[model samples]
Target: MQGFWDCMSLWKLLLKGKKGCHVSSCRVRRLMKKKLPQAWRKSAVDLEDCLKQERSLYKQAKHTYAAQWRKDFLTVQTKDAKKHQWKSRKARDRFFRLQQMKQREEARHRCCAQSKGSTGDLQAIQIEEHLSDGTTSLRTITDRRLVEDGCMQETRHAMIKHERRHSPVHLQVSKDDHVYFWPRNPENKGSKPHGLHNGHFKAAIQSPSIAYCDALFRNIPLTTGFVPLQWQNLMNFAIKKKPGDFRLSKMRTIQLMNSEAQANNKKAGRAAMQFAEAHSLIPDGQCGSCKRHQAIDLALSKQLVWDLLILQRRAAGWISNDAKSCFDWVAIVTMLLFGLTWHVLSSMFNMLSFATRRICTGFGDSKRSFCPPSAVPFQGCGQGNGAAPHLDLGDTVHHSGEDICASVQAAATLWLGGIRATGGAINPEKSFWWLIDFEWDARNGQWRFCRKCSAAPEFDLKIPGLYSDIEPLRRLEPDDSERTLGVMLSPLENHNAQEAQLVSKGLGVPHLFGKQVYKHLEMILRHMLGGTKPGAYMDANLQAHQLETGTSFGLLQQDYQNTSILASDTWLKRVWKELESLDMYVAFDSPALSLRWHHDALLIDLFIDLEVDQDDLLWLNWCRMFLQVATVSDITTADGRYIRQCIWNGFRDDTYRTPYNWPRTVRPGRPYWELWQRTLSRALLPSHGQHHPLLQPLGHWHDNFESWNWLWSPTVGLFHREGAAWTHLALAGSSTISRRYAPSGSHSGTDSLQ
Candidate 1:
């Protein structure tokens, strides 16, 4: 037994020593005294000293091993990086080669198809010649050759004249000190380089060599006002407008330009844009290319006008015109004339006008055989030019009352003349006009479309250049909605009903009982747990807690114990049973008469006392309306809760205040919150039971203005102690707020009234 104890002590010391621990002689001696007899005490001290020596030797070996490991790791990393770089370069080369091969195949296919058709015609001619006399056949061939020679001579003469017209001297480029090379940040300009040499832009900023080369190439065209003939080469192709649409009219033509040409165009376009903006050449109605103006802005403006016209019971006309090939038909000569008239820089116009396009059908087509004349009298801005959109000319007109037809005719005539002057035309087939008028229908108890008062039955409006009569547009009845510029305009009465229907479908609840229960659950989750945390996080936590306890985090059990109403209700039991089968975590609060589902974070609080009957169906419609408003507001669950909190606080204390600790409280201003409160109060309070505090209208709260003495103001400094500063504050603040909320006012309406 004594020997066994001694061996265990030795084994423990050996293990500790191997782990690089210093085994003290005194500590070993004390352990040995308890584990071994008095006879082994002296030997234990010697054993501890030996173990200490081994540990030091082991640590030295470890340090040497670690150093070697790090050295090898760095060497491997370098080799890997070199290998990756080589692979990337090889892949890029392969990609370019494949692209070239594909282009060659497409060109060959087109050539073969043309050749086959021509061969059939030639064979027929040869057969006819064989049947006819030899002399006549020879004479016919000779005549064809002579005509071809004359055509070639004419083409050569035309080329010479074109080259002379585009020469530097003709364009007036004599300045030697002109600095046309302005370096621009590619990132800021959103310039994405694509072509055979696109890789040059990848390291353009990092590598001085590439940047210098790009600058050198870009300067030549800007300085001389003559693009290099080779750079003018373009490949034209057609892409389908949609996946399965093969109609010729539905195809879009695309022109591909090299990276160098693209870069030059971008610089010239930016210059032109700046010039237009500085001169205010672009009209207010032209929102297509204007900064800070969007399609939605135009749509909202039109909608507002329509609404006003409808409200005033006035007849109005709307004309929608589309230009046929707006970018492609505008002549280069017209562009130059406009530029000169606008007093644009002579060099800029020279560069833009003189740059001719020679396009081929395929990228692999030979420049001499497939490409056309350098100066083909190009019309419109080439589709791919950056400055094309900025130069585009169009107009929108609005007129009301009896002179609507005359107004339309005059506007159309004026617009067409301007378009023709710019070498552009409108497509009458694609253009449409709408006659809008509303009248109160006593039979239907709502305002309805009055076609009789809107336009004459035999009215025929026409513009000379269009060569077709303008058609009256009608509202689509299939969907009960009319869409213009992607905004859906539905009848006022049906809009709310449609929203309610959509909400009912989304919840997947056909019965009033299920809907009522779900609504209560959604309310509690949105107002309580949803505000403090994200839906995903709360769902996961609740799910985990439910799984662990098998009782929905004690909520169900607590509800079962607290009240007999929920426990005894058969409908509530059925809902619970159905919920358990679903892939969701559900909890019920008997006191609040609320239920919550974990997955979607759906909480519905009936907002009724436990004694009140939960079977009422009258309030269900109002609940749906409130939910629809919240959804239409496009607010997240957390934001909805925060907005509700703001409203509740405002109603209770007559002061709207949100929790300072709330993460997103500072995002929405007082007006935004009040707007939401007003909207929600209108939606819920009108039909909802008066028992809940939220069912009462939230009147205007007292404006609790706090004086910020320490905060710095951009215009008035730390504190506005002077009268001049206060006056400036009043004017500037009002202007800023009005500007900020102008767009918001356009968006706020009865669109989500349901």
Candidate 2:
């Protein structure tokens, strides 16, 4: 019996020794596997000899490990080659796309020019003829030899004007308005030159040695408040205004100063803007050069006001006035006086004033003519001056009185009188006043123009310098849109006009729809595939579809259909295989098989619905979703119940209330399910509160709870919880929480519960 025990122990010891030997051999094999490939790459060797040595040491079959190693190496090589090929293909496609875009832009420009006719050329001829006429000619000479003499005379006059002015009040430069001699970007070519081009100055400023010399030159003028004679001289060019009649009056002049002078002018302009803003000198209504407000903001506000007036069945009047040669006619002395009153730094104003101009016609340099300060009625603020727009005077008046026309006329008269008092005059021909009113047409179910309530009266505006006799204000028709401060104002709905304008710019509805579809699909596919391979595939498919169907809408529809089928089938097969692997019985014909496919289909469909749907009440869907989720009562899970309570608490504590009265304003024509689906898709964004910690867990159960109470609740049930969950999961990841929607307290509470 003792001998038997000893033999058993010896057998166990032998087994242990074999196991250790196996482990040590594995460790050595792993090291060789890692090192051999690197060694083989570095130096050429006999593969047969290496395999023979490996076989002798490990007692392995011939070519077993070597064959596997070679397979892996070839696999890596093939993958690298394919990756390089894809990169080159992507770059090639990008180049072609850009070239095509450039061609489209050029074609659009040509088409626009053809449609507009030769008005620009005709206006140019008229301006030249007008300027050349002896009676009204601005040219002082016709000979090239007399150019130097004219320039000398102009310089003498500028010096005289400077000497005659009263001494300026000195003010210290603020840190906010400190002037920096920063170099202009090298890419900005074709700069209009006055003796020295901007490029030369830009290059000089980039060099340390030359930059020091330029700084000294710039500092001398800033210190003394005296611009050099050459810098004061300007070259003027005439440009025809678009949508204007072929006449000299429709032409505008742009002046180009020396590059160094321009740099100083830019600095002065920036300082002047800062000073004006600090003092609140500019009125809120003057949106042209203000930083706080934009011209678009004023336009949108006016549009909103008009809509409100229409809704209330009220009438309003507006008087819009434009100054003739607004920048050209601004009085230098008057600007200086205002600057003093406003406490602006006198050196900045001095740098802007005391300039002479020489007109450059298409033929030559205005026949050696120079416009001196004494010859021009009001000098200094030219069209190209950096601070010219701020100095140019303009005004708009809105009146809601019963007698709107009379109110507008009174306002216009007072405003024009004030403007004339300041040595500025309004162009009577360009100024206009029009009444706006709209009535609901029950037959068409939309607002229509009220001819009787809205009338643009032809009343004479009696202002002294503007007109010798009373001249009638031109009435703008209801259909006609007016451009004011770079914003287009129309009596009709501006959105339609804006849409038409965007369409003209190649951003039509179909184009936008396709772009959005591509964007959403690319996002989903990228998440699913875990790479950019899906995006490349989708782009290739889109290009193919674009070729197959030339029309934009047709191409979008075809691409969407193809992508839906391909993505749905691919995801369905993947999910089915995964289920089968888990030993879950899901028949091919089972209803459960369609859940993922349906989710993907509905997701894309909802995206399309939002893009194309023009219903005014479409925005209310998000509010409906939030309200429904807040009032849900059937959630059984702890997290689900907590989410509901938190949502309810949010509604109770906050001022935001459910839009219960929306139905009274707009009766939705679509069914509740379709609306719910649309809302689910729209609210997928994290900003809409979809990424809350409580909401993230629900996404995992979306496939299981299709028939949940929320899905069927038309009034206050959580019937599309799964849809909302999936949407949130698809847009924002399943585990990711929205920092914006999830409060710190809620996140901590949820974490503790979990």
Question: Which residue pairs clash in candidate 2?
Answer: 710-718, 710-719, 711-719
User: Lowest summed lDDT over 10 consecutive residues: which window, candidate 1?
Assistant: 657-666
Worst 10 residues of 2 by lDDT: 588-597
TM-score computed on alpha carbons, candidate 2: 0.41
* lDDT computed for candidate 1: 0.42
- Number of the top-ranking candidate, with lDDT as the measure: 2
lDDT per model vs. reference: 0.42, 0.44
Best by TM-score: 2
- Candidate 1 lands at a TM-score of 0.38
Clashes of each: 10, 3
